[model samples]
Target: MNSAKLSHRSPTTDHGSQAFPKELASSVAISQSLEELGWIPRPKLLALRRLGIETVEDLLTHFPRRHEDRTEFPQFPREESDVPICLCGEVTKTSLRRFGGWRKIFEVTLQESNPNALSEPLVCRWFNLHYVQKMIATGQRMVVFGKPRLRGKRICMDHPEFEVIENDEEISIHFRRITPIYPATEGLSQRVLRGMIYRLLNELPSTDAGLERLTPSNLAKGERRDAIRAIHFPASWEARDAAHEHLVLTEFFAMQMLIASRRADASIRQGEKHCGAGALLDRLLKSLPFELTAAQSRVISEIRHDLAASHAMNRLLQGDVGSGKTAVAIAAMLLAVEGGYQAAFMAPTQILAEQHYDVLQRWLDPLGIRVALRTAARQEESGPLPLFEHAGNSERQEPQIIVGTHALLYDKVSFSKLGLVVVDEQHKFGVAQRAQLSAREPAPDVLVMTATPIPRTLTMTIYGDLDVSTID
Candidate 1:
C-alpha cells in the first residue's frame, strides 16, 4: 500500500527524522481540496463549485455527457429504429425550391457509393435554410445523422444534423473512435476542461489520491489507473469501452461496500421501540372518510416492525402521487405520541411544510392532538404558536406532531421526547440536515418519503443505507 498523507492540512507528515517532501503526492491527492489546486482563480473556482466539482475526487467522478462514436460509417440499407442513423454520402444534386412561391426550402440529394442503396436516394431537406443552398455543392462528401422518414417513394431525412468531411485524414483524428463530450458550465469550454484534466493526470503521482488502495482483487494497478486515464482521453474505441466497464463496476462496488458499513452500524445502534398502535391512531384511522389502501397497510406494517425493533429505523417509503404516504406517516407519528413521545414532520420548502401543517391540523386537532407549525417565514408572521400559549404547563406546551421546513433544525427548537421524524421529499435535505433533526435524546426512528420513483441503480447508490418499501 502506498503511504499517502491522510491528513487534510499537513500534506507531508514527518516520517522518522527525515521530513517527507511535498511533491506529486500532495498535488493530486484526493485529500487535497480544490482550494489547493492553486491554478484556479476565485471566479473560476466558484463556477466549478456551482457545477458540484469541489474536490479532486469530485472532478474525477464528473463523467462524460455522451461519447460520440466517430468510428466506421453505417452499413448500407439502414434499418428503422428509434436511434438516429448516421451515413456518409456525396451530395449528387442541390436545388432551391419554393412552396406557393413564398415558403423557401433547400433540398440536397445524397447518394452512397454502395450499390445496396435502399431507395432512389436519401433526400436531405431544410426548411427556410437559405445558407445551406450555398454550403452544399454537387460533389461534397458529408456525414448526416437523423431519423429517416418515407417521403412519397424516396427515403428522406428532414433537417438532419451534419458536418462536412473536409479531408481523408480527418477520419482517423475525429471519426475513427469514441470522443467524449463533458458537461461544462458557462465560460468553461470543453477544450479548456479537457486540457486541465490532462495536466492533472500527467502531474498525478503514483501514490496520489490512494487510487491503488481501491483497486480490487480482480483489477490490477494498470487496469484501474488506465481506466481512469482512458475514460478522459481514450486511444481507441476498445479502450474506451473497457474503461467504461471498469469505472461503472467500481462505482457499484463502492456503493455496496458503503451499504455494508452502514448495515454494521445499524446493527449496534440503539433505538426506541414504540410498538403499540394505540387509541389515537385507531381513532384517526376510523374517522377518515376513506379506507386505507392495501399498499398503505403493507407499508404501515413495515414501519410498525421497524418501530418495534431495538435498532434505529432508517427506511425510505416510495410511492406515486396519491399512494397515501402521508397517512402512513401520520400513523407512525401517532405511535410515537402513544409512547409518550413527540414526533416531527419535515418538508423541503415552506409552502410544503405549511400544506402538511394545514392537512394534519384538521385531522389531529379534532382528536385533541397538539400540532405546531414552524418555518423561517412563520417567525416573522404574527406571534407564537398555540402550543406555546400554554407555556405554564410543560405537558400542554409540547406538540405531539411538529410540522416544519428546515427551520425545525434551528438551535432554539426543542422537543419533549422526539421519537419519530418523517421527512417529505427526502431528497431535498442533505445527510447532515437530516441528522440534525434525528439528533436528540434516544435517537429517533426516521421515515423518509419520496413521491418520485428512483431507478433501482440510483436507489442502491444513494439510499442504500435505508431499508426501502415501495407502495406501487
Candidate 2:
C-alpha cells in the first residue's frame, strides 16, 4: 500500500483517539432546563454544533429575521380584494381524503350579523389545513385570520392563521399584530422550534447577566426579557415588536463584533513578506492564455497591497467555479518568488496538488523559476525520476515554488525563505490545520481560496472575522 494513501485516511476512521463522550453534557443541561420550564426541548447542542453553532452566545445570536402575525382574527373586509383579510369564524363541517396528501381543505360556516341584526351564514373554505380540520372534528371553536375573497359567491381562504378556542377561553377581535418566525432545519418545523424556544425561555435564569446584557439601556432589563417571553407566547402585538427589535439588534451587533475581532487579529499581526510589483507580475500576465478579468485584477491589487503592508495578509478569495481564481493565486506566488521568497501552494487532494504543480512548472519554468512537485505519488513512482526519495534525503533545499497536498506541512520539508502560503479550496481543511499552516516560522502571509459563491449576507454572517476578497 502506498504511504500517501495510508497517511490520507480520515481521522474518524482511526480508533486511536480517545472516544468522544456518549452524550454532550451541555445538551443534557439544556434539555433538563427546557423540561423544567415546560418548553419543547431543542435539538442537542452537539448536534447544533455539527450545524456550526458552538456556544450559548451563538445560540442567542441566531435571531429571526422576519415575523408572521397570528395573534388575532380581524373581521373579514366587506369589500372584495386579493389582499388577505382577517376574519373570525367557526368550522361547521370537516372531511379528509385518502392519498390526497397531508394537507386538507376545510369548509366552514361563518355566523355574522349584518346592520339589520339578522343572522346570516357565509360559506368560508380553508385549503390544506389538515390540523385545523382535525381540531374542528373535535367540535372546537376557532378564530381564523386570513385574506378573504369571494370564490363563486362563497368566501374562501387558501392558507390562513387559525387558533382553536375552547369553551372556557375568550376570543379577541383585533388586527395589525406581529409575531416572530424562527429559522428551522428540515425535520424541525417552525411550530416545533417555537415550542422549544418557549421551553428554553422558561428555563432561563431570571438573574442571568446574559439577558441583562442583551437588554438595551433604553428599555428596562426586566421589561426587555419580559418582551422576549411574551413574543414566544404573545398577549399583544406591541409586545412582539418590542421583543423582535431587541433580539435582532442583539444578533446583528454580536455578529459585527465577531467580524471586527477577526479583522483586528488579521491586521495587527505581522507576517512574512515577499513583495513584488509590476515588473514580475507583468511578465507572468503576458504569458497567460487569457486576460485577467476586472474582478481578478481588483483582487490581485488587494492581495498585493496586503503583501506590501507591514502587517501580514490573511484574506479569503471567493469565486464561482471556473472563475479563473487559480490564475490569480499563481500570479501572487510568482510575486513572492520575485521578491526572493519561497511560496507554498497547498491543495486538499493529491490529484489537485499534482495538477497545480504541473501548471505552476509550465508557467514558471519558462521564466527560469525553479518549481517542485511533492506528493505521495512521487514516493511510489517507478521511473528514473524518484522525486519523493530525493526529497526524503533531508539535504534538498525548498524549491522556489513548493506544490503539494498536506505533505507541505510535514516536518522534514523546510523552506529557505517562506513568505507566502496559498491554500486552495480552503473550506475542505479544518480550522486547526489552517492554524498550523499559519504558525510556520516567520509566519507566511496566508491567502485562502474557495470556488463556492456564497451570498453577501451569508458571507458577512458566517465568516465575518475572515478578511474576504470576492472575484465575481
Candidate 3:
C-alpha cells in the first residue's frame, strides 16, 4: 500500500498500536448502548443520540458525506475557476470591514506557504461572520477549499471550507492523506466527529456491527464488515469506490431479505375463502355499459385467485387514470358480498368517496345490491333493504357495499361481517389507519388500490407482503 502523506492518528487494518483490548466486553456486540462503553463523555453521548446514533453499529455506519484528497495541495489560482479547489497557504493579513449599515465582511489574505516568483496571494472572504474573524490570525498556516473568483485584481474564495493547520502536525486529523467531511450538527465540529469515528474503527470490532456477508460466492467482492471500515476511511481511491458499491448492494440485499420474510409470513396466516361462485360478479359485468378490457379481465382474475386463498387476501391493485380499475374493484367487492360478507370501500378524499357512491348506487340500486355513502360532511344511505341474516350475523339490513372517506373508521360505523376492505389511493393514509381497518375478527381481506405513479423498487419495498396485480 502507498503510505505517501498518510496519518499516524488512524488505526491500520492489522489493529495498529492504537488498538484497545477485546476485554472491553461492551464493545463486543454492535447493538450495545454507547453509554455502556463509558469512554464517551456525557455531553457527547447526548449529542450522538440526538442524531439517532445510540449504538456501536450506528457509529460505525456514520459514513462520511464525502472525502477530500489532501495528499497534495493544488497550486494557488492565478485566475478565476468555477470548480472548487483545495489549497494550503499561510495567512499574510486579516481585516474586518464594516459596510451597508452595520454589515461586516471578514477577509484573510493567504499566500502559498511555499510561494515561488509566479505565485499570487489568495483572499478568503466571509460575510457577516464575526466568529470567523476571531479564529483567524496572521502567520497561521491554513487549508482552504472553494471556488476562486477574481474580485478587483485579487483571486478570492467566498465562504470557503477551512481548517488551521496545527504547527505541530502529528495530532491533527484535518491535515495529510484523504480527509473525511461528515454531515455535522450544531454542537459537533468536523474535527471532533472525525476523531470519534476513527477511534471507534480501531477500538471496537467492526465485524460485530451485525452485518454479515450474505451475498453468494463470487457475487460480490468483499466481506461487508471490511466494507464498513473502508467506507469511513479508505486506504485508496479504488478501495473507497469498491466499498461504496459493496455497501449499496448490501443495502438492497437487506431490503430483499425483509421483503422475503414478510412474503413468507403472509403465506402462513390462515384465511377464509372470500370468493364466491361468480353469480353476483357475472350479473355486474353483464350490466356494465361497456365491456371489460383484456387487461382489466386479467387483473380481476388475479384478484379472484387471492380471494380464494386460505389466508386473508392482502393485495395491491395498480392502474393508470381512465383505466377500468373501479369496475374491477366493484367486481372484487361483489365476490366478497356473494360469499356472505360486507365490503367496505374507503377513498382518500370526501369528493372521491361521494363520486364512487354515486356510480355504485346508479349501477347497483336497480340490481338490488344496496350501496351507502358516508363522509365527514354527508351521510346518505339508500332506502332500507331486506335483512341479510345468516348464522351468527349481528347486523340486520346492513348495506352490502358502504363507500366512505376516513369516516369509515369512525365508531358509529359498524359492519355485520366485514370480509373485504378496499382502500382507494392507498398512499394518502397512514399505516395505522389502513391496518386498523383490517385488524378485526378473522381479519378482513385487504385490497388497497392506487393510481399514483410509483417507482417499481419502492412499490416492491412498501407492499412487499401483499400480492400485486397491475392492470397495465
Expressed as tens digits, the lDDT of each residue in 1-472 for candidate 1 is 1111212121111211111233444457764687788986777778778898888767766778666555555553344445776676788998888898678889988887453523347788999977667768888876777888777666778898765655553233334345456888865655456556655665667653456535476753235666776776575556667767878877777778888898788667887786565788789889999999898999988988888887789999999998899899999998878878788899999998888888887888777777888888783212234545454655434577788898889877778678889999998899899988886657789999999889887887778888999888
Segments of candidate 3 deviating more than 4 angstroms: 1-28, 79-82, 102-104, 128-141, 150-152, 164-172, 206-211, 346-416, 427-441, 452-464
User: Per-residue lDDT tens digits of candidate 3, residues 369-458?
Assistant: 878888889988886644675688556576899999889898788887888999999989987898878878687789898898767878
Clashing residue pairs found in predicted model 2 = 39-199, 74-86, 84-147, 85-147
- Candidate 3 residue 263 Cα shift, in angstroms, is 0.7
For model 3, what is the C-alpha lDDT against the true structure?
A: 0.80
Which residue window of length 10 is worst by lDDT in model 3? 15-24
Location of the lowest summed lDDT over 10 successive residues in candidate 1: 10-19
For model 2, residues 1-472, the per-residue Cα lDDT tens digits are 1110111111110212111222322232322322233323345443444445444434443455445443343444554567654444555555554346665556666553121243334455656655556555534454555666667656566555555544431111112223345555544544444444533554455454455455356643234445455545444445556565666666676677777887787777766656876576898889878899999999999989878877777888999989988998988887888888888888999999888877776777678777877776662211134346654575544478888777777876677688898999998988778787778656688899998778888887877767799987
Q: Regarding TM-score, does 1 or 2 come out ahead? A: 1
TM-score of each: 0.65, 0.59, 0.80
Which one wins on lDDT? 3
- Choose 2 or 3, whichever is better by lDDT: 3
